[model samples]
Target: PAPPGEGPSLERFTLAEDELRTVRLRVPEGTSGTELAALCDDLALHDWLLTTVVRMLDGLRLGAGAAQDAGTVVRTLRPAVDHLLHLWMPGARVGRELAALWDPLEERPGFTRQWQVLVQRIRDQLTLHAVPAVHREVDPAPGPPAVLPRE
Candidate 1:
């Protein structure tokens, strides 16, 4: 049941070069406080994760001649990998009805898609950083000799 003239709605906006974002959700009249709180918490966590990752990326010079050192990149992004990456179970605790609230966000901004892309970028950076080390480790030893049997 909607309240008075109010109905379910989700209005989202961004400001400050995507550094600031807001989501206003109007749930049905009978929606429980617990449900609302859970939804808000989930949304807030994701917002923080998105903002933090964006900030981290902005601070990096991935392609510039003065690009960040590999160690610096790892140091900057390690917290996200260790702490935030595993926390993205959106709407997991919300009711089925309320969980549907995430649909619009997913469709328009494609939250999960953006997240996946960002995560991949982080992985690619780390992989690129590791290439030299991997090559060094895999260098053949001086005494490597193998006998080939005739097929």
Candidate 2:
């Protein structure tokens, strides 16, 4: 367990390897070609975003030397913060939400709830938009393809 007053560690934020394997197994065994393609695309996007967030947070924790850095430390934290902002600037509102989530751990002053918020937003966006977009794009047209007329 962490020292009293410290925030949860990045280990808490990680998805177990088994859980990821389970997600892989959930794809239907006999999906149609179009459905299979869409599923693959969605899985790829979901995996990429989740991995990116996890890596960023893990890097931050390592850089901060969370176990050894005295409470309220900030100097080693800037790179992690900058990386997150650069990657997610287009989703600034999401970033703000993340910061709000991480603000309560007074013992670990540099560790913020904002990281959790960022991870959640990225996951939510993947599920809500990226996956659906893949399906829409990969699914076949309802009818025959349109042919352009020669001039």
Candidate 3:
């Protein structure tokens, strides 16, 4: 449970269309149930990766998009990261991997380089997990057609 008086934690970063495209490219398609289960496990790892990166970015006062005060950002994001890791990777190999990544971060003076490294790692993993190529329907019209659907 969180300490009294603290606000709700930050949600994990949302995947944008580009990010989803990257993920689709990495994870193979037509995966069986067992493989899907394994991918779920991998997703846990990926979540932790994102959480850690966000934590570091928060500490540096780098907003996801908008600007925010440094202390407030850290306060909100640190707990969020802790909660996310606890939920996703509790008593598992994901915990070990996070610890390994976090150890160096603890000793680092500034977060800029570390943040870049984390982002690159995530991108690489997303690429690796991308689904195999599949045909996509291309609508000839870029915008809505002149006709409208009947009620």
Q: What total of clashing residue pairs does each candidate reach? A: 0, 5, 10
Cα lDDT listed for each candidate: 0.78, 0.40, 0.41
Better of 2 and 3 by lDDT: 3
RMSD, candidate 1, Å: 3.2
Point to the candidate with the largest TM-score.
Answer: 1
Q: How close is every model to the real structure, measured as TM-score? A: 0.81, 0.28, 0.28
Error of 3 at 6 (Å): 52
Spell out the clash pairs found in candidate 2. Answer: 98-114, 99-114, 101-113, 102-112, 102-113
Q: What is the lDDT of residue 91 in candidate 2?
A: 21
Off by over 4 Å in 1: 1-7, 13-20, 143-145, 148-151
TM-score of 1: 0.81
Better of 1 and 2 by lDDT: 1
TM-score, prediction 3: 0.28
Per-residue lDDT tens digits for candidate 1, residues 55-89, read: 88778889657657889988988888998888877
Span of ten consecutive residues with least summed lDDT in model 2: 89-98
Error of 1 at 66 (Å): 3.9
Please write out the lDDT profile of model 3 over residues 5-74, one tens digit for every residue: 4322212224565554112212223324454345445554644555566655545434255555434444
Among these predicted structures, which one has the highest lDDT?
1
